[model samples]
Target: MSGPRIDPSLYRERDVVPIRRALLSVSDKTGLLELGRALADAGVEIVSTGSTAAQLLEAGVPVTEVAAVTGFPESLDGRVKTLHPSVHGGLLADLRLEDHERQLDDLGIRPFELAIVNLYPFAQTVAAGAPAGEVIEQIDIGGPAMVRAAAKNHANVAIVVSPDGYGEIRDALASGGTTLEQRRRLAAAAFAHTAAYDRQVADWMAGETGQADRVLRVEATLSAPLRYGENSHQRAALYTFAEGRGIAQAEQLSGKEMSYNNYVDADAAVRAAYDFERPAVAIIKHANPCGIAVASAKAVDPIASAHIRAHECDPVSAFGGVIAANRTVTLGMAEQVADVFTEVLVAPDFEDDALAVLRRKKNLRILRLPADYRREIREFRQISGGVLLQTADSFDQGVNSAQSDSSAWRLVSGEEVDAATRADLEFAWRACRAVKSNAILLADAGASVGVGMGQVNRVDSCHLAVNRAGARAQGAVAASDAFFPFADGLDVLLQAGVRAVVQPGGSVRDDEVIEAARRAGVPMYFTGERHFYH
Candidate 1:
């Protein structure tokens, strides 16, 4: 395919253009007073609309209202305020065209050299759980129109769409006006801002109307640059969505900057910690759960016990891993972790004594997740050519039912699970879901004994789990994200002395697998729901 031919004459290259007049209208009003003062100091005439005009007037800045400039009043509840030909003609006129210049003069429309606008908070309204009517009303039509017109005529007009852009615009105007390059950059930013706004409205409406094909769109802002990606050779950065919660929202208390792998592993660890109601801890390495444990009724110190037990699951792998706890970190718990070389620790809060001890390790990263933080509603994955979107794996979904003795799970073979074993099986299943595909998780009491993740075959996962557990596998319970393909995989766990098993049984050889468990006198339960994290 041939590339589109470029027309050199359509483009004008210049060093700078002086600004004589500007139109300012904004919903956020951020930096408006400062920007107005700066424009006035530069001898630039300012025109504004509605509350913006009133605000500038109160601030003692001379300004003209949109209605005064257009000779038309706002109608349809202020929707038609800036849609006049006078406003658009000034914005669209081409300086190079004599006919366009003459037309502006013939209509007596004052050309605006600059436009400052930011659309209404439509996405914020939706996120606040506003009613559909209120959300629809928040969508700004005139703002986007003005932004597009100003952006399209970048050769003559400059556009400002964000409060962060105010400094550069003020600097340019104060230093003998803006350059062609600066105007082009600002125009591109304006277009992108409007485009994202439109996408948010479309997605919100599609969701309301039950549209079948929901095109995944994410408006994520860059949070920070990471030292490296999965490998030192690759490049990566972090992006935050909505109010920028989750991993990006976590406040770093003390330590070296978090790397790409640290964020990945920390995210997984925190998710696992959130699954349990009691005092729990999860240790993760390479985006896989190496250890997980919940406190039992008999434990005197729940937090410390949970941390110690979790660290005991795979002590070697836990050396440089991330640790996440649901409860606050106390001095005693900090003392336990202080013995090992941990990379990161995340929790709701940390006591002063705990911080004093943990901060001693200068390179250990510590993060505190906000108390009101909620998981995102949708999950996204990038594929080869496109993207995949689905509802997030919520804690109340299929997995949580088994914890409450819901009928969604059925005992398939051998014998009914006792109360203690059932609790372990549920805990194992929760941890298993956090692991990668082809996962097998083993648990005893309230702690994960072993975990096998990202294996190609079910049998290999079983073997990996058994090897990691060692003697701990004897009489331990296990959870599988999916059904075993054949009797061979079940036989491996049975021979390893896994007393009880939980799986989502929907394989072609389900009968054979059940029979193998029955013959081995191993109890098995079917959750009727698969959790494949790939």
Candidate 2:
């Protein structure tokens, strides 16, 4: 059967609605008493459910229980208290329609002018490592129902989903009542709140069930609006999720606002800095590391020495670049870098004297990250149509110098490496992982002498590395991001005094490459896995 057609003239928007009755149910009791008192002073009736009614009564505010309005007893552990016709009918009534007004009067239902609700702590419970049964019990059903119903009738009802908006709600009611525009804004906020809650629950359940190919639904709130994107003409903003701490969450104590290029280079710098256990520093230009160095065992001031070595690698390119340090920034290191024009500096901490010294540079950004910051985070990239998701490149963390048994490497030429040479080789391999392919790195004495990256051919990269290193290339170890397609690449490194090499041996001409290293008397090892970052 079809219902009677409604006239278009009957539907009209209400500019402001006076509060006659309201439904207030919340798990978070913040600002409840204040809102309740404001409504009471305005001569509005307050209806609540469960312990909320008890709290309002204790606060000397008049309240009507939800069960009393529905004419039914609370059942199913208080879950069935607000899922009745009286509540929905009041919330969904069309205030401008004559037929709707007659139906409400005949059913003895009073329309609700406001709905204040906040859902249960399902996300918090899951974060605390609760069991499945306990986490499932925290999901609220009737709360979302009433919230959606009130949001649908936003023309007549005002909705508030967060405690931060209580002041706005109070001022709106005090200045007469809520306007239509205010109600519409509140409605939009209510929908976003529910959507984020549901996404957290879905992601948790998918992980528990071992669903590998689950759909990725991200809900991020705006953190900041940048001055511009990669270019001056493009617009951009920053958004953050509810989980994990990274460069986005770092504390910026002093400096100007961050630009889009600053964030990109800062993230890449930190990813390389966090891979080493010893005190180290990485100087990044654009998105690639121009210089990388760790402290030597016998240095008096290891952190300062590392900074000097890194800065000396390519002083021209290091100007106005982002720098990352695994240890604290000290006065000595600050003095060493005072002459260069650095745009940003990130470290675990900064000494009191060092901070004061660096503050002289008015435009330098200084960030203090958490001590235990790591790179074991999920990565996402946006393309033309959709997003690509994968785990970050963190296998470098498990690489160790002394424990050669864990590596899938086999010595195929020259002789086995000593302890010190093996250590430098491990450092070189981890540093190469952060550079863009085709990548080649040379290191000696726990510091990178030269690095060649973002080149098209492997032979050109070797030439660049050798040219940068000059005399320092002698007796230095080398690491390649992938296997050499031809033996000439290995021969070039060997001729430049590269005594040892580490790379993923998987090319069809692996035998030929091994023979070339054998003739040059250079030891070579294969890691079985590649670490190309393009």
Candidate 3:
């Protein structure tokens, strides 16, 4: 037995009466009181323990406390309440097996037909960074016991783990009783519920005790089933892990079905938009920022700005891209967005007038993410056989710790860079490391003037970056996503009159490349972080 089996055959026999009691206990009492009332009304006794019993009594439902049903008083801070044979026998007894039936009859044991349970919110508690005592208290004990017992004997009993299943339970009872299929589904829910809780506990203990070698184990629940996966041929779903809520859980204001890529890049773009304090637009293509601009939304609000600024960032790449903003969209924003094409737009809000204009483009997708969207991020990546999960890659770029101050190399030989200029250079470097392979970025002031990505070679990227600038590349600082790897890229920038360069200098022929920069009298600095996207 690999723990507990949840096979369909295990629940094949559902005709038995169960003398069959239904045990109910849950911390999330969303539908519990109603379920308790229904079970009791059906002449199926309701056995509960501690708080559940108190809640049932308060709700005017007649519930037999475990102590009353088992003829044993609660003990040891109530830990010993439901572990007795009176409870287990009812849960574990096999009604169909003759010898077991005879033994149960002789021993005066009555089997339970249903176990309605929802575990303590251990995941939420741990995620809240709760104190040790409180976290320990939240770990469920008897609930898992009853659920396992019921699930183990699913052929005789039905288990309901989610409050959402309360309706199905009533419908089943109304139509005589639950079918074997229903029992199996409930069993699977019971098992999955317990497993997720257990992983949370294990992860908590590992982190709390400072276990360096321990790996973080995670389990998240499916909040919604996606229409399809990366392709329409595959099935997909969205699993939530941000303390049970996040932008992923945000309601859609207006949109068609969000495709797999839309959700992936929309989340990425939204988080990136919140990185800076200033009002900005982040246009993301294929999960990477293609154009990021700090601009006035034509007016004060983002929706209006979208009208005027949406396509202004980069009209071509903005097509089918995802847009995110930290501020509300204004009418000017709406007008800006109205001109260009995009697949999705997300923000803290959209003004009524701006939204009205946006709605004209009926097929465009829009989502109002939670007000506190940046608090936590659950990043996920696909693997061949499983998945790789982590906290969203940390957004802190350590802007303060820059190599600009030191004379590691010369930016302008004798011309000392001022504090303001150094800040610009540092910010440009961050934008550089964030771009795609063969990537080159031209930064003037705080915004990108030109960006070249996914080029064949470093020289090609340099030409494309400067060419995109048209006339702006002159005197603009340039940054590359990786080491030059050769001097041809540098020669092209010198020809374009780019004054400064930033890149990761880790090539075997780095000295040669550095010598080339020295010859061109152009200052080139190396950022250790190499960003590569495939």
Q: Which prediction has the highest lDDT against the true structure? A: 1
lDDT tens per residue, model 3, 386-423: 77765443345444333432245334232445655555
The number of residue pairs in model 3 that clash at the backbone is 24
Clashes of each: 0, 0, 24
TM-score attained by model 1: 0.86
Collision pairs in model 1: none
lDDT of every predicted structure (CA atoms): 0.88, 0.87, 0.73
Error of 2 at 143 (Å): 1.2
Candidate 1's C-alpha runs over 4 A off are 1-20, 37-43, 58-60, 93-107, 124-139, 167-176, 179-181, 204-214, 298-301, 397-407, 519-521
For every candidate structure, what is the RMSD over all alpha carbons to the true structure, in angstroms? Answer: 3.9, 3.1, 4.5
Q: Mind sharing the TM-score for model 3?
A: 0.82
Model 2: colliding residue pairs: none
Shift of residue 236 alpha carbon in model 3, Å: 4.8
Kindly list the per-residue Cα lDDT of model 1 for residues 1-534, writing each as its tens digit.
Answer: 995554657644545778899999999998999999999989999999999999999999999999998999988988789999989998988775566678999999878889999999999899999999999899999999999999998888999999999999888887888888999999999999999898888988898989826565567778899988989999999888756568779999999999998998999998888888889999999889999999877878788889999998999999999999999998989999889999999999999999999999999999999877666666788899988887767465453323433256899998787789888888888878888889999999989998888999989999999999999999999999888999888888999999999999999999999999989888899988878888
